[model samples]
Target: MQLVSEFRPKTGDATLDGLLEDAMVRFLSRRPADRQDALEKLWDAFERVKTLEGSNKSVAVPILLGNAALGSDPFRELLTDEFHLLTRVGNNFTIRHHEIGKTPPPSDHARDYLFVRLASVVAVVLRHTGRMA
Candidate 1:
């Protein structure tokens, strides 16, 4: 398990950050085809990371973002796609999936709420990872 603290975001490069976030979003998706497509993006992200000084803390953020994305239940159950970026960051950082909210109400509205909440997390992660927010 990689510690959350170990993952850092690249702070100064706006363009690079956006690319990483886009890659992460694709990787986080719960589809095989999407995962495969995201892998290339992940490679690009890594290239950006390599450009940073080894001492930079922000370099680790991709690992954290990938873990969080892959750890989500839908992504994990597929048992096929793995988060390569997360592994490279180190085993110290671990991504855990938690029920984001209380037991949903028995109505259709509940599902909508859950979707909104999850989407919000994704958005935040993307903005943070991309350095756009």
Candidate 2:
């Protein structure tokens, strides 16, 4: 499967779009550091996109995700779960920070997996909120 291609969507917010674009560009590098950077930027964008709806972060996330409005209950649950998982990975890993106990992604495959997984949810939220097109 393709992680990123020529058809990346616009996130409307210039900063957010740049974050996503930069993440994709960084992911193109073969270096492990670059992949980690990609996840960092993607996660940053993910947090910022949740606030686009004028609601507080906690309230806005569910609105941004949209409850059962995308298609069905399963899809909604999947998206919500994915978002939470991404957030947890960011918090627990060395992608964002390297303080004391955070662990870096084990391999190149794992790094790539993280970048793509996080980016997917960020893109979906942007699209659902009309921030992406």
Candidate 3:
């Protein structure tokens, strides 16, 4: 929880930031059940990347590739049951987008629904973060 609150996206690292965005998009587009199975694997990869401190981006790249190959884990459970990930991503994206203040796409309604779902997850996550973090 606290980890997520503290986890501002690392924009300075353009490559890593792009990878994270791609991973999130992939996860968001997946089916719920498959997302769950895939999320465990994705989380595992993130954990692995955290440890690849000295290996340079090459080490992380494979992990990112593995995550991309695994596909998006739209595991709402991770947001509902877990915490940090959804809230941070949601809150960050919400704030980030608004700050940039771009208009929603042509599919604004659909995008809104997705954003709402993601926000709900973020709310749950924030509560979890308050307790756990």
What's the lDDT for all of these models? 0.42, 0.75, 0.38
Question: lDDT score, residue 83, model 2?
Answer: 79
> Which tens-of-lDDT digit does each residue in 1-133 have in candidate 1?
1111122345476765666556556555766555444444544554454344343535654454544444565643321133343333222211111245423234434333332333334334444346334
TM-score, each model? 0.34, 0.86, 0.25
The regions of model 3 sitting more than 4 angstroms off are: 1-8, 30-48, 51-53, 56-133
Residue pairs with colliding backbones in model 2 are none
Give the per-residue lDDT digits (tens) of candidate 3, residues 53-99: 33565564334333333343554333323334533543344322345
lDDT of 2 by residue, 17-118 (tens): 788888888888888788778888888877777777654988877776773247667877888898788888888898777889999889889888888777
Query: How much is the lDDT of residue 4 in candidate 3?
Result: 26
Give the clash count for model 1. Answer: 10
